[model samples]
Target: MTLIDALIQYGLFMAKTLTLVLAIGLLLIVVLRARPGGSGDDDDDGSRLEVVDLNGRYANMADTIKAATLPPKMVKKAFKAERKAEKARAKAEAADKRRLFVIDFHGDLMASEVGALREVISALLIAATPEDEVLLRLDNAGGAVHEHGLAASQLLRLRSAGIPLTIAVDKVAASGGYLMACVANRLLAAPFAVVGSIGVLAEMPNFHRLLQEKGVDFELHTAGEHKRTLTLFGENTDEGRAKLREQLEETHAQFKAFIAAYRPTLDLSKVATGEYWHGEQALSLGLVDAVQTSDDYLLAARAEADLYKVRYRARKRLLQRLLGADGARALARPLARPIGSVARWLRNLGGARCA
Candidate 1:
């Protein structure tokens, strides 16, 4: 062949080789992604070690892949075997008739977390029988009022379904957190878990003075007189401050009333003073029924009933998973905000809706 033709042929061969290598790499990624349960070993001793390496942002792709890779027939057989074993085990442990469902709430109250909590509550409702007891392992300092209220309302589903609900607070269940715990038939808390704060607050900084000092004029308009209160740039008024205070007081009263309604045993006269207490103190104050951590309760209950730690599988759509992983701020813009402000608003909205 001519030197020019030979060079072109070599270049084509190299390109083909690169393409093949790229194809193989893509195939491997696909295979890894497909095996969702993660890499693990099933030993001859009937023990399996499943490795779930989740990046903690998206749905656990590793678990999905593993579950997907298993054949439907085999999965069915395995499920049947597990059920049979469970039945036999339950019979053997007849003395322990109480089944325990542990519902854990450990993070900030966000929309995604709320969604997951809702799913968990729903699953627990379905799985729990009349005799089975539902235990919520709650640990939240506080968060957006509405979000936490919704979370608490999800717990109420257990009550509506006639399943007994017990809230076990280990760290804290203040403000909206308490809103959820109040619904439980029994409220248990660890020694130092912060337990109460029955009030509402809203704040905004006014740059009106700064702007005026710099010889800058600010103007704002609203369709409704009360649409925007305590503005950032607008002038303040005695009437406006009074109105805001009145609104807050009304919300606080409603919060107090809600607690009273759910936990009639509590002394609203004392506990509604916008103060928090430790777990033992809270029990005396009637904020909690007993002092117990979820771990202790779970360990004790494992002897008799089947222990299931229930949480919803966070099933994110493909786009969200990709965007969340890409550090795409714009994708999360709708969900992002000052954490405190969001929590306050969530609580306020939730209270208003419930009221």
Candidate 2:
């Protein structure tokens, strides 16, 4: 072969080697950029929970970007601006159409965290116009008497304002839960969601037998005969038992009468039997009006008027904030505190078993 030909072949070999190396480097870079579970990346948007301002402030669709899921620190930021924009947009759009406010009530029915609920309801009552509707997404299995009763009273606030209230139950709304549902002008439920247990129950244990075996006598003193009918430590007389039973019967009667007043059309004799029915069966029994889920209801009504979900932001307790201090000390000794917590939990378990 000629020397010039050999030189040309050497040049071609070098060019091929350089191109292969560059291609491999580009592949590695692409793989590194596609890593999973990134913070604030485009790929992570769908998996992240969004903090939506239902009140109407950030109307610009682009402004509602994938913000970081709300941490305690971020939640402290005022959502007032976003809420204002949303409200303006809603008001403008609702000028020609009817609107509805859909609210949810789930989990244990108690007045412990009721302050937040009252605030949300008060806001809705003030913002709602005469043409707007109020829909409650109620799902409660019932709890303490006075607490549930107060929760039910909050629903009446909307009614008293002359706003139409509709209740949609996706799951169980029994006992005190039904007390709230019955207040709505119309009630809808899913096919299998438990409904109606219009009754009250109270149960307590009497340790009289155990105390007698241990030779421990307990004394009782009361001003009235009914004040201390069923005692936990003292023997219960027939008169005391009779009195307790009478009290329960009276409460049950009052519950039935209350339901009758709200729903005069319901057959009081059959529904007051303390039995629950599913959605279709409940419709036949007059417990609910129709079968529908909250999602379908919202989607169907979206084109008619602006839809807003009402919920109260839960405040963190002082103790939790104190323990979760934001400082170098917290980061330095995080494991120490976590280990101590586990140890205390184990100690409590052992003590409970021994007792």
Candidate 3:
């Protein structure tokens, strides 16, 4: 085919894709409008822990362990004693078994999974026993400071409850991701997983010179001196730059403290130098405790306990479901005044009806 024909075909395909996406989006909006807040579960009891037995699927595997696969050779002499102790055996077996609860947190720039993590931890706290353990599968390249900080605190909830928490980093856990990983009692990572980027970063595009050339005035008012430091359109001064650096340093210090509180063996001064190490390197530097995939850990623990993958699937707001995260936020500011506007309109309509 000629170059022009190929280009035309590609353009047609993209247009078709866009059209399909728009159709789906509109269909979703119609569905949401038909049933708003009708999914039920407006109470705390709505969120529940879902448990799955891991051994059921892989029971025949070579590595599988069964406590009583072979029965003791029963003779007529011992048959009477065994019959009498049958109920006692059942009670003893029930007391010996423990549970393993699993959760997954895939973080982005905003660390949105923290909300669900909080709910999952709260639910588990009520149902989990002291012998039971929690495993978190974490995957992120790190993002915002406060966002990941809060996400880390959610993991700390498991620790505060004295529940054994293990973090599995299959791909990457750097910066804010590492912050949350450190809160776990044990950290597992893939052999080549990127881990341990303990640092701070701030980047902003400055259009001050362009504004100057265009003779545009951008005035920023603030209550504090360092409140309006580095900005997009404003001319940055040395004092503002220094203050920004100071704030970054302070945040970094807090990050270090958080890591230290959990994993006291690590020397943060060395590994927290703003560079990420791979899983094996991280183990040598005391960043991660072991090199293992999430699958490997789960499969190995299957024989010991009843493993359950827990999740808190929160119902999204009507607007959010229709427009998604970014589009919802983009339209949120304008929609904030709707309640007052509707109330005022109803009052005026009532007055007119009375007249």
Once superposed on the true structure, which residue ranges of model 1 sit more than 4 Å away at CA? 1-89, 93-98, 109-112, 316-355
lDDT of 3 at 328: 76
All candidates in order of TM-score, best leading: 3, 1, 2
lDDT of the candidates, in the order given? 0.70, 0.70, 0.77
| Candidates 2 and 3, the one with greater TM-score | 3
- Weakest 10 consecutive residues, lDDT, candidate 1? 49-58
For residue 349, model 3's alpha carbon misses the true position, in angstroms, by 43
Error of 3 at 264 (Å): 0.9
For residues 41-157, write the lDDT of model 1, one tens digit per residue: 322322222222112212244335645888988767766775697679768777756676666677564423676677666666666777898877877766556677678778878
TM-score of each: 0.66, 0.65, 0.70
Predicted structure 2, TM vs. truth: 0.65
* Predicted structure 1, TM vs. truth: 0.66
- Give one digit per residue, the lDDT tens place, for model 3 in 75-122: 333545644665575467677878888898998766778878888888
> If candidate 1 were superposed on the true structure by all CA atoms, what would the RMSD be?
15.8
